[model samples]
Target chain A: MSDSKAIFLKDAAVNAADGDQRAFIRKALGGYYVNRDLQKARYRDWERARDAASLAKWSAVNDLAAVLEQFVANFERNGGVVHWARDAAEARDIILKIAADNQAKAIVKSKCMTSEEIHLNDALEKAGYGVVESDLGEFIQQLRGEAPYHFVFPCMHVKREAISELFTKHLGTAPTDSPEELTMIARRHLRQLYVDADIGITGANFLVAETGQISITENEGNARLTAALPRIHVALSGIEKVVRHLDDLSVLLPMLATAGAGQPMTCYNTLYSGPRKEGECDGPEQFHLVLLDNSRTRLLADPEQRDALHCIRCGACLNVCPIFKNIGGLAYGTTYQGPIGSVITPHLRGLKQWNHLSGASSLCGACTDACPVRIDLHHHLLHNRRNAAKEAPTLFDRVFHHGFNFVIKRPWLFAAGGRIFRATLPLLQKLPLPYMGAWMKTRDLPEAPARSFRDQWKNPDA
Target chain B: MPDARSDIFARIREALKVKAPRPHLKGEPVAGKTSAAAKPWLPDGGESAEASLAILAEQLAKLKAMLIRVPDHASAAKAVAELAAAKNWKKVAYHGHPLLRPVAAALPCEAWEADASFEKQRLEGCDAGLTTCESIVAQLGAILVSSASSGGRALSILPHAHVVVAEAAQVVPDLGSALALAKARHGDQMPSMLSFITGPSRTGDIERILVLGAHGPKELYLVLVG
Candidate 1:
């Protein structure tokens, strides 16, 4: 096993058994379930809505090259600069150069998982530039010196007392256990950052091809502030974020909110066509869009799993996934953590090392049911398993299959083996079988039948 | 050296040679056979204007945004003044529009109009922001605020509370109509910033508990005038 796989195994074992943490997550998501059902009831036909949402995104992914070129042309015409980064290193370098060119003194950012995926903050910090997370959840995680516990609800697992303590220690605020009070503390603290920050960084939820716009969905409005105040605005996003048309948001925005957080719409779903127009009141003077591929095209190369690009990042699949609920988000040990993550991580990173994720699913298909864009998440897990085995079949794999094939090919040999098993079942149960200790630890051998099924079928009267 | 853009596009083109199967929606048309105008499956917005307004009120109430209706522009101003006095707003920021200018002038508290580009620090000091919206969607209680209509981006978001002044004629049935309105008005010159304000800014980030204000507008009100 790879080092990441080992750490993942160890963490999954520990976190799954953390009953208290599991209960907390379950109770927290209970409200989400109720709210989602309530909002979903408002839909004329929720399943049909999913069909449309899926088709809208598929329209973009199906003709990606042409649509991307069109988006770039329109975005440039709207007075925004576009930079294409083939990988993470190039992306970071491009951003750093932009910050240097602008002589940026202060930088504030909203919640962007793409940035987290590329480890952008560490790159910026190592280069001696200060960056602050303006989103309330991101701000808390930043002060705690941790990655997000969950992407959408970044610090969901944290208790109130710990947050109060964190606030007291970091912001020098009075201790308070009230969630609203803790929120206000972060709000009051970050208010100044938005005003004073010289440059702002954000992530695009969707990039519109026909309109050349980027839509950002947020509940807290930090993204709006990030785009509004700074003289220079830089956005980092995955290449798969582009969708075909502006009207597609009409179907997508409501579904994203109802599925993501159980609301009609998030408080802010803003679209930016470009930097501040010549006669507009106030916005960033310069807008720079950095498009990062970073091995996404690898996943795209396999046509069977290309629909994985249809993911809107709603994080719904994570909510319903049994493994995610038990082991929690951090145990996945990937930037994305859940069924969707399990399906695509191998492709994004590498099948050999990350294939362990594929093995962890229960294959209940709850994720497929919950997915807004209909990615076929559970089957992709099976695909990864097949692909991984094809790539590197181990000694054990060869022996098990070869042995089974040899016995099954000969009916007489199979029947003899079965008769021997029936005769020695009791003795076999008592044996401390080599290579089967872990499998037998909590399970018992089944009772063997008196006659083979073939013999019974041949002598029906007897 | 080939550009990263070309290289990425090249790979995508190669991958598209094999097509994936269409979604398994029973009775759904095959790929490339679906209608050009995709129908939304959202909540029903009533056919008539009055019925739409009723739906808007119900939706807004559920979303925690208060919608105040008045007979005319003068009554709208009176409502704003009353709200200012009731809430004891220290100062407010507003856009410079005919519909809102009189209301801004009549505010019980000091009002600053951001008609042109302005400083961020001053707007940040205000207790509330009042702006005119492009349209309001009745299907979902969404306010479409563009930079052209809403006094840029900062006015709506920077303050502690946001109050939007809109005419009843601006009310539309659904989200699609709102998008069509923007496209019809702007054409290729899309506004740099166009946002759909759903309710007061909120977050359920802390232990999944709802908090009214996380970064912007703890309170949101819509003063709808006929």
Candidate 2:
């Protein structure tokens, strides 16, 4: 087994038994499920809306090169600078160079998972920049010196008492159990940093081709201030974020809200065309958009699973995945978690090392049903498993299959083995037998089937 | 390194050769095959203006946003004065706009205009921010505010409470129309920033529990005048 897969098994076992962690995930997601259904009903037709949303992303992703080229031209025309990074290292260097050129002292950021994917915070902090996460969950996670527990709800696993303790240790604020009060503590703290920071970094939810604007959707308004207060604004986005037109957002944004968060609309969905234009009141003076490919083109190369790139990062799949609900996000150990992550991690990382993620599923279609853009998630996992076996089947896999084939080819040997297995079935079931024991813990070896298929065929109605 | 721009494009070009089709549109891998819906996929505000207004009010109520309607601009100003007196606002921040200047003037407290350029600290210190919006959406009770129209981005977002003053004519039925309106208003000179604000700043981040005013205004009031 791969190193990542081993870590995943160990973590999954521990987390699945963590009563406190399980309760937090269940309670939080219970609310999300209720709200999502209620808000979904607000749509004229939810399934039809899903199809429309899917096509909107499909059109952009299928015609990716054209739409991206158009977007780049229009964005540059809008007086914003565009930087293309081939991989994570290049993306990190590009952002560092931008900061150095701007002579930035401090940086504030809204929640951008792409940044996390490239480890931008670590890169920037190593280069002697004080980077602060402005999104409340991200802020808490940052203060705790941890990765986001969940991508969207960054610190979902943390209790309020723990959060209060974290704040007291870090920010030196009075301890409070109130979620609202804890939010105010961060708000009060980040306000000054926003004013002082020379650079603000953010993530783009959708990059509109026609208008050349990046739309950022968030429930809190931190993204607004992060983009507004800083003199230099830098946004990092994956190349797959492009949508065909401004009107596409009109369809995509509502579904993202309802499916992801169960809201009529998130509190803020802002479009940024450029730096503060001439004759504008206040905004960043220089706008830089870094478009990172970072092996996404590799995923794009696989036509069978190409629509996985259509993910809006609304995280609806993560919310509904039974595996995610049980094992939690940390165990996945990828930048993205849940079904979407499992389907694409092999493509984004590598097939051999990450293929175990595909096996982690129960072939449940909850994620496919929950996806706003209708990426065939479960089928993609199956494809990953097949491709992995074809590409590099382990020696154990080969030997086991060979042994089974050798026995099955000889009818007498197979019959003898079956007779022995049936006779010892009760003992085998009772004994704790390593791998077989684990398997049989949740399953039963069906009552020895009374007689074998050959015996049943020989007798008329045995 | 290796001309990232052209290289990335080359990879994309090569990748796009083998087209992937949506399940329903399998023959030739149709680009932009938008499914024609029998009814509008999103909630709609009927054909009439009154219908739009009624839906907008109901949506706003659900969002916990206060919507104030007035017969005229003078009543709008009076409403602001009364709200300030009731809330006991110490200082208010606003930008120079014909629609909202009077409302700011009636604040009966230190009113600061964040004009073309202003200090961030001054805006941050204000109790409430009053600004003009480009358009309001009735479908989701979303207010579309642009940097050019709303005295820049900070005025609508920086303060404790954001009270937007809009005319009834500015109300649109849906988000798509709101974007169309922006396109008509700005053409190529689009505002550096355009934000669709649904409710006050909020987060369900902490334990996935709802909490308002995470990093922006806690209270949001929309004052509409006819």
Candidate 3:
């Protein structure tokens, strides 16, 4: 393993064992699972909805070229500008240019995972613009100068007391710890920023090809203000977010809400077709949509693993993942986390450095089951592991596998090896074995039998 | 930009060289005709409009939005006055919808025009904003407001409290019906912004505790007129 990866795993292992963090995650995610189950029960045929949504996404990915063209045409027809970005640098440049052209001094942003993927906030900050995150969770994370703890819940790991401290330190609010009071404090502070900001930046949940509109779903209503009050509005999204029909939201919206937050629908599901229309009083005067292709085509290039692009970023896999619940979101050390993150990060970033993430899972199929788009996420992790091994196999792995294959193929040698292992179990346990010690850190080794099952089969009486 | 677009498309075509043919791209409306067939799996609120309205009310209440049923536009105006008085709002900003003239006239306090020039200073000064909705979703208890009918996105979002006036005829069974209505009304030219609001602005980001009015209206009230 790379030194960085080894250190990351070590840090994650230590963090996973923290009692307070474990308790917080368990309580928070447990409540989420309960609410999700209750909300899902309201649907008569959730599985059918999931299947149809998956099919729609599959069709969109298949006809991506035509669909994207149609979206651009319709968007332009509605007075929206579309910018194609081949990489993160290009995308950043496009946004920076817009900000520079407008002479924008302040910017308000809603929660967008794609923005997190591109590190847009840091880039914009470096350019000397005052960029503020409007989403409450993201606002807290930003104030603490930390990355998001979870995809949906950016500050899920932070406790209320920490938030009270954060507010006191950052906003200079009274030492009020109540959630409602804290929300009001943020609302009062950010409401002014929204009005004064020259630019608003957001992420699109879905891009409708037929109408040339971008759908943004949120409960906090920050996205609405961010899209409405600014003179310039820019939406950054991965090309995979495109959907074939506007009616697709009928199925996709509920699926996303139920899977993401256990709601039938978020409070605000706004579709921006273009900039403010000819007679419109509010909304941005200029609207720009940036379609980013940062190593996504690489995943699309592999037919076998292409379905990984179907992920909706609902984060259900993370909520249900045992490893994530234990080790937490920060452990993955990538933009996306949990099962979907592990499967795609290697491809999105690079395999050699991130290949270790594919090994983080127990290969359980919960992620596949929870996936609304039916991405077969766990199987994708397996594919990543196989590809990683093929790309660069270490000498230790080769030697161990070859030795294991040789002994297992010979019956007599296998039996002899088993006997030897059972006899030396005490010695092995006594010795400070490196690998076995690490394995035994969180688990117990099963006791070896007195004799092999093969031995018994050959001579039962003995 | 053009080069990047073409290059990405070329890569996609190369990657999908041996893929299946896309049937939906052939000018056949896959969702248009088969929407009904796809409707069987969706939740059934009711077959009658009355039943759907009941479900809508129940759902909206669950989301913490106040829903008041009025007999007609006159009563809607009265309800608006009563609500404004209860909230002690002295000044109200209202969208210039012809249907909302009665509510504007009946307002007990000073009413301000929410027009194109309605800037942040005016919105902040106003205690409440009144607007009209295009439709309401019964299944999810969502109010559908478009820039065409609701004045603009800011009217429904920026005020301390947002009050929406809607006719019972505008209620629909689900989001699909809402989309159908928009398609029929505007055809190729849609409003720049179409928002579906379920309740007051809220967040659960701080310790997963529910809090209202994160960055929009702290209070949401629906006055449904028949």
Q: Candidate 2 lDDT, tens digit per residue, A1-462?
A: 799999998998889888877887899888998988888877887877777778888888888989999999999999999999999999999999999988999999999999999999999999999999999999988988888877788888889999999999998999999998998898999999999999999999999998899999998899999999999999999999999878777778988998889998899999999998778768899999999998999999999999999999888998888888889888998999999999988988999889999988889898999998889999999999989988998886789878899999999999999899899988876776776644665677667777888888899675
Q: Which regions of candidate 1 deviate over 4 angstroms?
A: A422-425, A431-462, B24-40
lDDT of 3 by residue, A368-415 (tens): 888877787888888988888789887866888889999989989988
Interface RMSD of each: 2.3, 2.0, 2.8
**What is the Å distance of residue B53 in model 1 from its true position?**
1.2
- The predicted structure with the larger DockQ, 1 or 2, is 2
The candidate with the higher lDDT, 2 or 3, is 2
Q: DockQ of all candidates, in order?
A: 0.65, 0.67, 0.58
lDDT of 1 by residue, B23-99 (tens): 65656533322322344466776689999999999999998999999999899999999999999998898888888
TM-score of each: 0.96, 0.96, 0.96
Give the true-structure RMSD of model 3: 2.5
* DockQ result, candidate 2: 0.67
For candidate 1 chain B, which ten residues in a row score worst on lDDT?
A: B29-38
